[model samples]
Target: MPGPTDHGRVLVVDDEPQLLRALRINLRARGFQVATEATGAEALKAAARSAFDVIVLDLGLPDLDGLEVLAGLRGWTAVPVIVLSARTDSSDKVAALDAGADDYVTKPFGMEEFVARLRAAIRRGAASASPEPAIVKAGDVTIDLAGKRVTRAGEPVRLTPTEWGILDLLARNPGRLVGQRELLTSVWGPAYVGQSNYLRVYLASLRRKLEEDPSDPRHLLTEPGMGYRFEPS
Candidate 1:
């Protein structure tokens, strides 16, 4: 039951009973509504039913791998997710973040740091959460925003995950200038917002795949010294 004192809703997914209990108690005491699930499958079902302010996820699950869960959630929602995992490998952390987790915390973390990270994720989720179009049409390319599929000239066009992320943001706001800074931050993360070269490379790849003329793009337009635009005419 949500109360007047509740700060926001939190969904915590971990297989450990003790850990789940601790997180629920701590989060609820901090004025956040809390839901706990032991498996990734249940977590996905709960997420589908109710919107949450943030999600704390553990990479180890009995039914579904945490990375798979992240992919499933990103297919529909932009809710902030903090991965709570026992795995300390740097590669594992990078994979989770790339798969859509907002943050990753290894096991035996301090409660203070966990809460602080969750707060940051909540802030980010608020700014990013919104509805996306089902489909967008460009000159000879078609973007199925909801399905995460794309086609060019009536043929399917395979795109890498990074390419899809860049294109998805632009297609969501057709004819609107999606600034370079926003694209860099949203797709790559805040740290890489200064890396304009990353955007150039991915955008070039997107253009090559979806544009009839890669050199003279009709749909994907670059605004000099500004950003890129998707002219969905």
Candidate 2:
């Protein structure tokens, strides 16, 4: 029986029977609903059919490669996945992370540490599960996307049409990367797709109006050479 706080539903994917049984017993004893799959195909099917709080996946699978399964999962779901593997090489860890794994735990790990990691991953997933609210509050600033309004410290912040467009797009997709070219083409016309300077200028103006410190933005983030991500605190 699970208590109020014991709401974690975990999916463990591994080909090794002994490891699966051990994890199932330990996790279930700790009041986690545990589901196990022996093959990557089975794991994919199980994940598609159910809603899991977190996933513990083995890199070495009998049918499909673990990375392939990870790619498949990332295609439709944003579920948190932790990679469990015997490969100790840094390249393997990097590959797994690049393929969308939330965390990587080398094999022969301590049960206590693994459980702690599982808890942390579940916490992160839960935090990012919900979309941004209608009125997004970040530090001293608040953005009302639906109302097309921005305020800071109880005062309305004035913004141009272009600035509002950029802020609105970013606010709608919190914690997800919005590419530069995508932003330009969407906000401006397709002819302005390569005009990266437009973003730099508009973003600076946006920060000045909405951020407490224009030079160091908190909610508005830039992934150098890649894109921007809006993080709501």
Name the candidate that leads on lDDT.
2
After aligning candidate 2 to the native by TM-score, how far in Å is the CA of 99 from where it should be?
3.7
Give each model a TM-score: 0.59, 0.65
lDDT, candidate 1, 66-164, per-residue tens:
999988998888788899999998778756765667778999999989999988778666655545568888877788988999987888999889999
The TM-score that candidate 2 achieves is: 0.65
lDDT, residue 164, candidate 1: 91
Clashes of each: 0, 0
Instruction: Give the top-scoring candidate (TM-score).
Output: 2
Candidate 2: clashing residue pairs, number: 0
Tens digit of lDDT per residue, candidate 2, span 1-233? Answer: 12476859999999999999999999989889999999999999999999999999999999999999998998789788999999999878766765667789999999999999998888778766766568988887889987998888889998999999998888876776666765787799769867888899888888878877878889898877656778888
Error of 1 at 208 (Å): 19
